[model samples]
Target: MGAVNLYVTEQYLLLKTVDTLQQKYGFRTLFISDARDEFLLEKYDRRINHVICIRRKTFDWSNQLKQDIDSYLRKFYQQPQLFRGKETRFSIVYVSNLKPVDSWEHLSKTMRLKGRKNATVTTYFVDEYEGLEELGKLTNTIDKNDNWKMEALPPISEQERQMVYLEQKIVAIHQHNQRKFEEIFQFGKTKWTFVLIIINLIVFFLMETQGSSTNSLHLIDWGAKYNYAISEGEIWRFLTSMFLHIGIFHLMMNMIALYFLGEITEKIYGSKRFLFIYFLAGFTGGIASYATNDAVAAGASGAIFGLFGALLFFGLHYKELFFQTMGRSLLIIIGINIVFGLAVPQIDNGAHIGGLIGGFIASQIIHLPKKTEGTKQVVAIIGLITLMSAMFLYGSQQTSASENPQTMAAIAQEYVESERYAELIDWSTDRIDQGIEHEFVYFYRAVAYLETDRLDAAEDDLFRSIEINEDFAEAHYNLSVISERENEIGMALEHVRKAIELQPANEQFKQYEKELSQKSTSG
Candidate 1:
C-alpha cells in the first residue's frame, strides 16, 4: 500500500498509524510524501533531489512506476512455483495521491494478473478536486470501497490549510536566506554579544544549583521577577531578574537572541551606552511587569526587546545601512516573535513593551562622543529623568493597590506570595472602602477576581480601573485581553491600540494590536 504526494508537516504520527493498520490487516505499507515531509522520506530516497526529480517528471515518472509494478506482478503470477518458496501467499498493492487528470486511466477493470489467484490492486484517488464542479465532469467518480476497490483518507479541511500556511511562513524566516552563524557573528562587532551570552549562561548554572530554574521558588530566589517579592522591597530584582530564566530552553533562546542582537547594538551605540540602555530597559520592564501582572515572570526577553528598539532607532538615523545589512532579517524575526507572543499564553508582555520603549527613548537621547557631546549628555539626562518620573508615578499608584499603609502593603504582598488571593482581595476592598479609587487598586482586585474565575467581576473591576486612570497602559492591555476572551474582537483591538499609544515602545501591545486588528478584519 502507498500514499503518494501527501502534504503534511510531521509524518511520524501518520506513519505510525499506517504501520499499526498494516500489521493488523497483514499488508506492507509505503508512503510517498511531498517536500515538506522530506525528513521522513530521507532513508527511502537515500539520494537528495532523486525522488523529487522523479516526482517532477510527473507523467513519465508515474508511468515508469506503473510499468515496474506491472512487470513485478506479471513475473510473480507467471512463475508461482518460484514465488511459492516465499512466506506470503496473498499480496495487495495500494496506490494513492494521484493528481486529478481526466486522461489517466490510473486503474481499469481489464488490468489483471493471469494465473495469480491472490493479487489485489487498489487506487486511492484523493478528493482534491472539490469546490470546482467542472473537475467533477472530468472525474469518473471512483466510488470509495466499491466492489472491493478503493479506500482514501479524507482531504484536509480549510482550517488545517491556513494553519499549515502560517507555520510554513514562520519556518521560512532566515537571516538573509539562512546565513551561517559565523557570518552573523563576524559581520561587524560581537564582543559584547558574546559577553552577555556568557553572563546569562553563568546565571543559569547557579540557578540550577539552587534548584531547577523552572521551579517558581528557585526562580524567585535567583532574582527571577517575582512580583510580590519586589513589591515587598526586593528592588534589586529589577536589575538581577533580567539575568535569570525559568528553564533551560528559555535561557538558551534568550542567550542566542542576545548573541544575535547585542553585537550590532553595542557597535552602533558604543559599549557604554549599550550597557546603559540594556539596564534601563531591564529596569523599566521590571516596573511594567509589577504594574501589570501579579504572577511570577522572568527572562531576558524584555532586554532583548530593548535591543530591537535600539535597532529601530539606529535604522531611523542610518536607513541605508539598516536596510542593507540585516534589516529584513530583523523585521522577520521581530514579527514572528511578536506574533508568537500574541498567539500564545503565559508571556510577560508588559516587560517586553517596557524594555522596548526604554531602549527606543535611550537611543534617541544617548549619542556618540562628538563635538556636541555636552548637549547630547544634557538631553539624555533629561529624557532619562522624565521616563523615570513616569515610572515612579505608576509605582506610586501601585502602592494604593497594596492598601496605602506601608505595613498593610507589606502584609498584602505577603498574602500574594503565599497564594492567599482572597486575603489580597479583602485588602484591596478595604482600601476601596476607605475611598481609594486608584486604577492600581482596581486593577489588583481585577487580577484576584480573574484568578478566581469571576469573569464578570473582573471585567467590572478592569473597567472601573480604566475609568480612574484613562492613561493606564496595563488596564487597556488587560481589558483588550478580556475582550478577546469574550469574542469582542473589535473592542479588543481598540483597547490594545490604546495600550500601545500609552506605552508606544511596548512590543507586546503592538503584537496584540497586530493580531487583533487582523482577526477583527478577517472576522
Candidate 2:
C-alpha cells in the first residue's frame, strides 16, 4: 500500500484546482505527470512527484506505456518492513480521456475484482476544451467516496489576472521610488555631497560679489596668465576658476544641471559611485583647463559634461535597460549640449572634453562591481588609475610651478622671442625635477639648459623628454642643439633632420637645422 496519488495533465486550470484541493484537505498526496509535460505541470504545482515520460511511439501500444507507468509507481511506492509493521495502500485519481459516469464505475469495479481491495481508482472523462466542467465532475467523484471529503477551490477569473499584473506593477514602482530617494538623500550620511554643494555655492557667491572681476577673467586673459601661472604653481587657479561663475544666471543654470544629472546618475549607480564620478570628472576638467586654456576658467560645467558622459556610457553599456527605452531622447539631449559647448566661445571646450573622458572612464570603474575578478576588469581599473595619477601629478606640478615669478617671467620671455633654447634652460634647472617627465616641460627645460651653457643637463632633459613622449618634435630639435653644443657633428645633424622629419613646416625646427648644419661644418 502507498499514499494517495493524484495524476494531472498539463492543463493549467485543473492543476490549480488540484493544488487548492491538496492545500485545503491536508492530503499527503503524490503527483505524477508525463516527462514531456513535466515543466508545464511543475509551473502550476511544484510538489508533483513520480513523473513518467511517455515515449512518442508511432502506434498506440499499451505495453510500453504500462511498463513506464508501472516502473514509476513501483519506484515511488516500494517500502521495506520497519518497526511499525504498517502496510500502505495505493489509490490513484486520474484525470484523462472522459466517458460516461457509468463507464468509469465499470472500470473501478473491474479493478476491485482484480484483488486490490485497498486500492481505490477514480477517472474523469473530460473534453480538452471543457476543462472547467471536467474539474467540477472530478470534484463530485471525490465527494462520493466515504473516505474522501471535497474542498472548495478558488475560482479563477479575468479580474484575478488583471489584479496580479497590477500588483506587480505597483511593486516595481515602489522599488524605483525607493531607489530614487536613496540617491537624492545620499549626502545626509556621507556629507560629501553637502560639502561639495556648500563649496560650490560659496565660490559662486564670491564671484557674484566681486563686481568686474568676472569681466577681467576672459579665456584669453586667463590663458596668458595660465601659461605663466602653471610654471609658478598656481594650479589651484585652474580648478578654482571652474567653480566661479559670472552671474546668478550662470550659477543657477550650472547648479540645476548638476542637481538633475547627479540625481539621475546616482539613482542608476548608488551614491558612493555617483560621488566618485562627480569628483573624478571635475578633476579631469581641471586638468584639461590647465593643459589647453590660459584663461581663468571657473564653473561646474566640467562636472556637468562628465555627468553627460557617464549617462552616455551607462546607456550604451546597459543598452537593454537604459538605452532601449529612452536612448534616443538621451542622445538628443547630449547632442544639444555638445553643440552648445562648441558654440559658446567663453565655454572651456578643453575642460568639457576632458571631463567627458574622465566621466566615461569613471563610469566604467563605477559600473563594474559585477566584474569582481576578471582580466578585463583588472585592466580597466589599472588603466583608469594610471590616467588619473598622471593627470594629478601633471596638474599639481604645473599649478605649483606657475606661481614662481622668476619661472613665469622666463617662460613668457622665451615664448615671445621663439627662443626654444632659452625656455628649456629656464625650465630645466627650475621646474624639471624628480617625478616630472612631461615632454613639454622637459623640452623647454632642455632648451633653457642648452642656451645657458649647460650641455650635459640639456642632453639629459632632452632624452628624458623624448622618453616621455617619443613624438615630440621640439625635444628632438633640442636634442640636435645639445649634440651641436657638445661638438657631436653627426649626431647633431641626425637629430635636427629627425625633427624636420617629424614636423616639416615648422620654421623654428628648420632654422635649428640650418644652424646645426653650420655648426657641424664649422666643427
lDDT of 1 by residue, 338-455 (tens): 7787676678777887788777777766753231456765776787678766775576467545533333434445555667789779868977886766677778778777778787
lDDT of 2 by residue, 87-135 (tens): 2222233334333333223332213212333332232333234534644
Runs off by more than 4 Å, candidate 2: 1-195, 210-225, 324-326, 368-374, 385-523
User: For each candidate, what is the lDDT?
Assistant: 0.59, 0.54
**Candidate 1 clashing pairs?**
353-506
Top model number, TM-score: 1
In model 1, state the lDDT of residue 490. Answer: 82
The window of 10 residues in a row where model 1 has the poorest summed lDDT is 45-54
